[model samples]
Target: MADTQFSLVPKVINGGIAGIVGVTCVFPIDLVKTRLQNQQPGPNGQLMYKNFRDCLVQTFKKEKFFGMYRGSGVNLLLITPEKAIKLVGNDFFRYHLKQEGKKLSLTREMIAGSSAGACQIIVTTPMELLKIQLQDAGRTATVEGSKAAAVKPPKISATSIAMQLIKEKGITGIYKGCAATALRDITFSAIYFPLFAHLNSLGKRKEGSHEAVFYVSFISGLAAGCVASFSVNPLDVVKTRLQTLTKGSSDKTYTSWMHCFRSTLKHEGVLAFFKGAGCRIMVIAPLFGIAQTVYYVGIAEYILGIKK
Candidate 1:
């Protein structure tokens, strides 16, 4: 029992560190994904940026390089706890759900992953709200025309945004799209964790190691993340739109998740649900690859002198 308790501490630390590393590495791609997902067609039915590459180029050219990292500060700050809760929580549930022989069935794994996904939404919602706000800020400017270019982008500090959200809409404002966020995350973890585990297990270096090499873990996570990311991208798009849309914006407002879904399908067509699928795959692939490798490598254990 003591050993089990001791082992759990490392999972939390490693998960947090992995999140920082992964988010930092793929934030630019994630920025592009957010923009692509949130953008709607103009009057002529032309989109702001044609594709991920176009979005990346335009953002750099217009908003400059730092523009690609608009919400990185708050994202990085909140990602630690968010990931700690997710990865650690998954492991916690998995440990508890394991059978007498320390075996976890696929069903149990999915349950554990789902539980972790649900647990993280509390942090994920507000964190994502702030992130989407900052990420979509540039697009908001473009949509508004002259007034947008004339005025400087608001210096969106986390503290300021938090204060403003609280003053205007209270804590609820920070969770604008909780339902969509939950759906996306739950589906992602349900697919990702079990798939990753199966792939990782197949590549284990030796019996009892219960750990794949860095490359194996990386590849497993990348593949699983891409598949999982693409699968739930529609939900992701809805979540992004719901979170970023201003209350009284010229664009349509989504009163609920179903409204967002039906409205998007009706107006944007089916393909709109997949606007950022490619970029999302790219972002999630590396994000999970790095995260899985980092977690499996147990670097945090060595640093913290917690290795068994």
Candidate 2:
């Protein structure tokens, strides 16, 4: 029989490990997605990247291999807790939301997932703000350098960014795109968790066991991630633009998410909202594939002599 008891410590540890592994493997792709989403048309309607391929090629040519990971330090550090809250928080809610001896209703499952998404934004907002800054800093520097003399911009780090935001705008300064983040994450999780659980349930299970096979979980996570990532790409774009502090003089400032949405729709059109969608799928698929597999595999359980 499966272990019905919830063990907080093991779940937290497993979530942290899953997060670290997933972020490390996919951070480069995520950086590309951020850069793509942040790219706005120039005064003459010229864009920095024609497409994802162009963006990847340009980044490789200009920034090299290491540059692909520009903002990864902060992402890796904070993603641990952000993902921990998201994954384990979902499980925690699902465990409680279900009535004893009854399957959880799909609505309750969505609520549980949404609650997890809400819980994670406390860390996600600041983490994303700093990450977008660092990831897009190179693009900003590159554009400026091309127009001006070929001088490299001074290096900036996550610690410095946090300190400056704290000093200049207080602690709340770091939560620049919180509303957008919440919309994207909550929607994504609501869709993703239910879909992943459903798909995983349909897959092959271990002999005489309730759990799906590891590969099944991975595939379920990947499929769910791709669908959810694509579905929320518009919100992701808005969030990226809102959080970006290194806007050119021509860039428009928005008062809120609605303002940003309307302005972007008016200026850039609907297709603009899908910026970096492909890259986001690329990043998220492997991320949650690896993350869910590791999480379900119960590494902590093995270590601590707990069975699930």
Candidate 3:
């Protein structure tokens, strides 16, 4: 019975295991998303990203699989905390909440998830900023590269990007878009966790038995993924913008989150808010379901001595 729950490994170990596997699975779409979000307006201030397949093909043609995997090697940044927060912290909340005698509802899930998402932004933002530079041909994070006559990007490394942020902007540079990212996290994770919990519960209607972990897990994942995407689509765009700023730029002029958001919308449009969302929905929504559901039902179960 003890083995029927999470395995004996430390929560961090379990989270690390899940994060590495899950983030690697979804990185390509994430690459495309960063590129699309950071795209500069054309001469007429036009938007980019015609479609997913076109971007994928062109990316492979230009950068090969390497191109498509921009910032991928450094993905440990995004993966570590993301998995830790969701898998470990999220589960922790459920366990704790259960002991409180208050009814477990979607609200608990949302609160746990949102908190984790907020932490993830801090853990992930700089790496994300670097990824944007690698994905786009026209932009780079280095002083010399941004200023060169050709403006060709140097081979910016994840280590270099982290170092550069420290040198240029101090600790603040690394936390560039935290307010926005926090908001994004708060809304989306909040929605996803509770939604998933509810969905997972739906599969248990037939009996109070704990046997249907896989079905419950899948439904929970699917619901959480869909709802989260919808709730925080705009904030995700804002988070990306704040992350992709070049070094030494003055963000002082922007003043507030609304200012930056309005500026993007004014220059772009409503559709600008949803640049790569369709691809994200198609990819991330489903994968979110598969990741957690698989973890709880299949992968974690293996560790827990359950077979189903």
Best by lDDT: 2
Rate residue 171 of model 1 by lDDT: 85
For all candidates in order, the CA lDDT equals 0.85, 0.88, 0.64
Clashes of each: 0, 0, 1
In model 2, where do residues sit more than 4 Å from their true spots? Answer: 1-3, 147-153
Clashes of 1: 0
* lDDT by residue (tens digit), candidate 2, 1-308: 32578789989989999999999999888888988888777788867778888778777766788888888889889988998999999999998888877888999999999999999999999999998888888677766666434334459988998899899999989988899999999999999999999999999999888999999999999999999999999999999999998876556788899999999999989998998999999999999999999999999989999767
lDDT of 3 by residue, 171-290 (tens): 887777778877876777777777776666567642545544665676667666777786677887777776665522322235557887998788778887888786666556766766
lDDT of 1 at 225: 94
lDDT of 2 at 76: 86
Judging by TM-score against the true structure, name the best candidate.
Answer: 2
The TM-score obtained by model 1 is 0.93
Clashing pairs in 3: 110-190
- Candidate rank order under TM-score: 2, 1, 3
Pick by lDDT: 1 or 3, better one: 1
List model 1 lDDT by residue over 1-308, tens digit each. 21245377788889999999999999999999998888887666766778888889877877787888999999999999998888888888888887665568999999999899999999999999889888878777776765225333556666777788888998887788899999999988999999988898788573445456789999999999989999999999999888884421456778898999999999989998999899999999999999988987897779888644
Superposing every Cα of model 1 onto the true structure, what RMSD results?
Answer: 2.5
- Screening candidate 1 with a backbone cut-off below 3 angstroms (N, C-alpha, C), the clashing residue pairs are none
